[model samples]
Target: MTATPRPGRTIALVSEHASPLAVLGGVDAGGQNVHVAHLAAALADHGHHVTVYTRQDAPHLPPRVALRPGVDVRHVPAGPPRHIPKDQLLPHMEQFGHFLADEWRHRPPDIIHSHFWMSGIAALAAARELGLPLVHTYHALGTVKRRHQRQEDTSPPDRIALEKAVGHGCDRIIATCRDEVRELAAMGIAADRTTIVPCGVDTTVFTPHGPAAPRPPRRHRLLQIGRLVKRKGAALSITALTALPGTELLIAGGPPPHQLHQDPEVRRLRETARRTGVADRVRFTGGLPRESIPALLRSADVVLCPADYEPFGIVPLEAMGCGTPVVATATGGHLDTVADPATGRLFTPGDPAALARAVTALLADPARRAACGAAGRRRVLTRYGWDQVAAATWDVYHDVLALHPSHPSRGRSEVTPGPAR
Candidate 1:
């Protein structure tokens, strides 16, 4: 067990990967980046001093960026101050942990919340040295990944075991979905410390419109956004398009086209499309600026997310916020976010036939699609807004503090109380 925060205690967020300011055009900058960025800003809005430490991906960068009134991004030097693929960064956790330990020697955080496994290792190391209370969120559990990706698992075999250890060792584990809670329990994590918090969306940016420009007559636009990877189910989405005639699938992600042919996922997806006989209908737009995503969602008739595993499905939430109905796999956060037959539909994971049915049904019926899209917009406003998500997170922090007092889990030293709001 660990001590809770004292009154006006400052907190540190350890995300060895996923820099808040990094562009989301790479394999690493997917959901975790959005999760940490939004959570930190939201927590700051609630009057808690927050310092988010991420690997420095560039040289000559400021040590901190005041993201909001109280939230700041601290670019820590772990490896080279340049982009390093996340999988390759695991071996550098020791260096990351040491950097945090050094930083805490002068100014320690009251509570440490680490995101992902490597970050958790860094957090655990720093906490062990300073007696800081640690909470962890395994954005994508290795066990879950192995099960979904199976023979395709690129993660080291020890990844699952390491994740399991972290899940059990942390003072508390924030499981993004109830299913994950069950999975954690099965993996030997304490059931008492687990909290279910779904990833949130900016509903203000993604809302339904009055009569969307009538989608192309005789041709439906289906959008699938995210890193183009096997685990993300990009290949499955392309295959589903084969079931719907005159349906054009737009795949948005990956580096620029000039450099895309070298990326394995992009090349694989293109090959899959050709093999499935839908290559003509599939368009890999590569990575577009994040700001352009809403318009892309609004223009599409249906958003496809057939991901095999999602700790929390942000894409579906973003689509729903944009008044675009989603057809996602009934797994992970998708189970919690998308209501089958209501806001959107869910198909069995990895089942191209099931996905085809759901997508084809949505594409063929304009009235049903419109109704579902409207419902999705309403749901996001009521549940997934950043304000609401932040408030809930604050409650968790307070609860932890109230439950433990003597331990003073602020690591070895205490950070100077800075303005967080």
Candidate 2:
């Protein structure tokens, strides 16, 4: 048998908070974690040796676990060997960067790609010290948050400014949508340094004609998946369900219902449903296994996403892949993904009345729903599959490596260069 040459050497993925192995179906298992994990597996399939570094949240977690043939997870010791929320992980970036630097001292990876703000901070610091090429993907921008939230936003006061710095400092910014490129430019990130690479879905798993598992029989089922946060706009969907009689709204995210009562957002959602006289129609599924999400989507008549803002909403994409139509707000990435009158309907963000009207119209017409679902599945498979996303990301890595080769002191190639480069 002939030997196959390697493809541009090893690459490191830095994700401080979201571990690839962590169960999805929680408050934090929205987009970033899925993007990183799927992207790594896809990249590995393309013959790249990939190593994902995430903060170790449990002592029992192995130091390394193979995801695919060429992909591995590396649990780096940062703060405590226990779970810590994303909001509390900022102070440990310096330690994360130091650990990364030490890891690179002996077995250096060709390039480092970081996900989220704190990961970007740690990766940038480590890259600067090691003279390594760095690529960053900020799942959500702070500038956008401040613009959307104004005074009510509870994010750290300095998040906007710090995110701006990360965007400008990184070797290249991976904008998940064209809208994000505009947001980055507004925050002073050079347009030329930004590449638009949207997150992708696994079409093989989220197919249109698959046999969906049995779901509770209801007059009609409307699904909403993601965190129970103000930005997610789940409460708006719950309120809208009241106007559409006989429709069962299943919310799939967050902890169990008992634990949910402890959350202010969950309580607010319950209150909104009661005020709208739809509390009985809405059911919170709490958190379900990630493997079970596709089946859930397949059984839904319509998927609802009323997020106030999103860099790229993966829930709608997942629904689309499962041959399900969506009713999402025309904000941020939703405007790019959902084609009005084609794949699904779109309404103004924060307008429950408008959202209710859209959902009502979809529920009234079964043929229209079928047609839209077919179109949505075709759209995702054609343009937003994991293969396409992985290739695009690899291209970015190659471009960065071509621009910067060996360190000034090392004088040897850290990452293999193409013949011409």
Candidate 3:
């Protein structure tokens, strides 16, 4: 049986590449950042002391920064104290692990929750040394990415093997969706040890009664929001715009607003829109403020997500929360979240024609769109609230801590303690 969690218990969240403090919509910053940020805040609101340990990406950032009343962000020194692509940070896990071991020796957490595969590797090492229970959530699986991107995938060669090891070693695995459970099973993770904890939305912020953001007047509006990566299928959405004659497609998220033109993916997408003869119809609003996203979603007639594969998409839920219907590809988490012709529409992955048909149908009928949007908002309220997500996650943390009681004397060293710098 699991032990009851005490009030004020400290929980450590390890997210190596996705810092909670980073701005959203950048190449390395998206769903994972939002997930970690919101989860930490929710856990803190539950009266637990939460400390998020993330890689120190910039030299000017202090070693520690308070995120909220009960939440703190600890900058773990690993690799160069500067931004580096997530793929390149794999080789630095050993250094990250050692730093964690040193830090925990002074003040260990009751439980450690690691976010990505690399963070899992680092946390696993420290947990083993300290005899502390560890939980892991792989935001994206290497096997799935490699399968989808094939030659274009740039993940480390050993990511699959390392992930397999981490999956086996973790006390509990939190699968973001049912599809992820199947992938985990293929990698030898037992079904009994894994739990499905879907990503959530802040319904208070994303509501049906907000003033919509301003946009150019068009017969209908189609919106796509995510990183400007090839696998995200933003280009596919651009192609679909050609078929929807009067509808305008708004692509939001890439580099910062100032640096959008320099982004390689943005340039590629621009050319694609030009080639498809929809350049004038498509607008790219690069990296809008996080607070403005709900307004942006509300402004859309229909939000679209054309990802080739997604573990779990927060955007669709956000749109749904805003009472805006979504048109998403029938893959990954979309299969679980979207109810066809009810909450939103779903089409085959990578099919621009199918996407166009769904968008046109939704746009042509205002009543159906409003009905779908209402149903979607209802789904989000009852199913995908952050409070529920945090409660489920806390249950997992308690389960792990109960199974493996910590050994306080094991991690502390005989040598004199150094200054906490």
Each candidate: what lDDT?
Answer: 0.80, 0.83, 0.88
Give the distance in Å from residue 357's predicted Cα in candidate 3 to where it truly belongs.
0.7
Can you give the TM-score per candidate against the true fold? 0.90, 0.92, 0.95
Judged by whole-model lDDT over C-alpha atoms, candidate 1 comes out at 0.80
Sorted by TM-score (best first), the order is 3, 2, 1
**Candidate 2, residue 135: lDDT:** 89
Better of 1 and 2 by TM-score: 2
Give the CA lDDT, 0 to 100, for residue 165 in model 2. Answer: 67
Q: Write the per-residue lDDT of candidate 2 for residues 111-181, one digit (tens) a residue.
A: 88999887887777777777888889988887788788888755566666667766766778898988998
lDDT of 1 by residue, 1-421 (tens): 2223233568788888888776675787888888888898777766678899998888899988998777888888877887787777776777788888889978878788899988987777777766667778888888888887788777765676667666655677777888888888888776887977778887776666533433456778999999876678989888887888888988888787678888988888888889989998988878878777888889898999988888887999999998899999988899999988998898898899998898888877899999998899889998899887766665566665555435544322222111112
Model 1 lDDT, residue 111, Cα: 81
Q: How many clashes show up in model 1?
A: 3
Clashing pairs in 3: none
Model 3: per-residue Cα lDDT at residue 352:
95
lDDT (Cα, 0-100) at 254 in candidate 3 = 85
Candidate 3 has its poorest 10 consecutive residues by lDDT at 412-421
